[model samples]
Target: MKNQFFAAALIGLTAAFGAHTANAQEPQRFETEAHAIEVTTFASGLESPWGLAFLPDGAMLVTERPGRVRLVSPDGTLSEPLEGAPQTESFGQGGMLDIALDPDFADNSRVFITYAHVEGDVAGTAVWRATLQRDGTPRLVDGTQIFRMNKLSGRAQHFGSRIVFAPDKTLWFTIGDRGQGERAQDATDHAGSVLRIDRDGNAPADNPFIGTPADDLIWSIGHRNPQGAAFNPWREELWTVAHGARGGDEINIPKAGLNYGWPVISYGRHYSGGKIGEGTEKPGMEQPIYYWDPSIAPSGMEFYTGDAFPQWQGNVFVGALKFQLLVRLTLDGDKIVSEERMLEDLGERIRAVKQGPDGHLYLLTDDPDGRVLKVSPAS
Candidate 1:
């Protein structure tokens, strides 16, 4: 009998090797400047899988945007949607979003998730913490809503909400302007900012904006709509990829109390082919380490610090939704020196990119039949 749960995984991976019955495409390999890489479907039949995280044991946790979480065993058995996920609404880019395990998940059994919490017509970005129970039945319990945006909006767009744990153990999350451009410049508004808070949702004492007239959780202001965030352990700084209006997708290393010139300055034109924000450079705003013109609609980002491909170490990876490809950025210390676009023929809107513990690159596709793809070095 054909295995109903999963196909055979490669590289000793314990995660999905593509859904047994749903995947049929042959794996493909592409040559790059540093190394030849192979892309294979690790799992399929996922509905808009937005976020992916690997557990210590190599099992994977995946979140579907329409509001569900599931466990994918290495052998390809998929768990039922875990209960106790926060209630959310899905419309115009709002739904259950990123997922991250507690830094000490092995000891705490805690997990964090970001979603669009709905209240009437108002929907806001929210973070919910829960204890993941996998004994007998897989489910979430002891749920706690650790954080929610201070001001909810009726609009369903621009919920920038990728979460990462800083080296200091505090949580950092992104929020967009909720389609209100000027809102990003407001220090008091959570929208259009990078926020840092304790795991319990309290602002840390040393948060840069604490004594200022900004919200306690606000770390930096003037972001457009950041969808991808990762902490570069090598530099001990937070890096983010944010969507631009028409042509100005940006990659910024947001700093404490600094403004990132969104509505004030941008490299791309407005959707109407008009000028944007003082023509890209201003006196007080920070410039992006790099940016994309004619916007590729970048989403998830990963800093390659894995051992599988030693040459790829110190590189950066980003998934592009608009162009349906993966981007590898060659960085020289803090500066991005070159960019190579790959996997354009994969034919999926790559939503998120994750570096697994084993140092392989994994991705989530954005579609009704979304999938988890694993990228490894090609021999």
Candidate 2:
């Protein structure tokens, strides 16, 4: 009788702390309109995998949040952790983040990565570039720190990192608000801005703020914590997805020298239900193309131009962390015509989305025992 009573009490305590429980529900399948797709586990045993990049030879490079990068062969074999990755500040929301192959990777095996780093007592996001040599033992050579966030903060959250190459061959990357709202309005700071730089981390001569108080590297300002960035090849525009405090999650096309209006004009309220900034609109600020009122917590995104799904051509796919699903946004030019929630049955936090070289969509689930899932037409 005594043991039964104690077990009952323990179960009650666990139920009371339900908010702290990790959602580890198993993956499930669902049907789509234009195609019947099957979601298959491509690779498993990844410790919180955050990013995925494909090499020219169909191999893949995946970033694990606990500061490791692993190579995945086409046959689903994961290599031992690669060497020469930087020592990252891995805690809370910080760690090894996004990875991208250099545009000329066929000629130059250059690769880029973003991660949170600590110097002394301060921590911030930093971008690095290195040559990946596959001869004998695969390793990174000539690693260089390309860009580091300007204002270091003790806060570990909101390291908005995603990397994409522009049509002009320059690199565009994001830096979040660092949990400090007012910093987004400061031009002198690199936090809360989308920055553009050359392959060697040099500020482009044609940057809009060359002579202003703003940093020369800043391309656009007033972002909260933008995690998703991609270039539309057809439109030649840069699109970003950002997180809001409580409700408003947004998608914006970051133009040169534009202000995105985060705290100063947010559709989201504080977590405590208090109003943020000036209540959602300002004359000089640019509005998002679309927004979510309840906050989906979007992360990685990509525009689909693959041949696997003909009906999905030109649509935008974004990963949803809070909702544990994938969002497919239909686009009619610059406007978002409709949104379809997908893969909800997976019941896992979808962290990143990338269209593979084989014209199928791949996703990374965020969990200690995370996995890489591939979506293809159902057989």
Best by TM-score: 1
Q: What is candidate 2's lDDT per residue for 1-379, written digit by digit as tens?
A: 1233223222111112001212344445569867788888887767888999999788889998878888887766677778888778466678899999998989999999999877765689999899899998778888889888888887767888999998788999999998888898888898899999999998999988999888999999999999999999899989999998898899999998999998899899999999999988999999999999899999999999999999999999999999999999999999999999998888989999999998999999988877888888887
Kindly report which residue stretches of model 1 are placed more than 4 angstroms away from their true locations once superposed.
Answer: 1-25
C-alpha positional error of residue 359 in candidate 1 after TM-score superposition, expressed in Å: 1.7
Q: Which residue window of length 10 is worst by lDDT in model 2?
A: 11-20
Candidate 1 worst ten-residue window by lDDT: 4-13
> TM-score, each model?
0.93, 0.92
- TM-score between candidate 2 and the true structure: 0.92
- Model 1 agreement with the true structure over 1-379: per-residue lDDT tens digits: 1222112311121233233333666779988888888988887778788998898888888998777788887754567778888887566678889999998898998999999887765778999999999898788999989999999987768998899998788999999999998999999999999999989999999988888777889999999999999999799999999999888899999988899998999988889999986788999999998999889999999998889999888998999999999999998888999999999988889999999887889999998777888898986
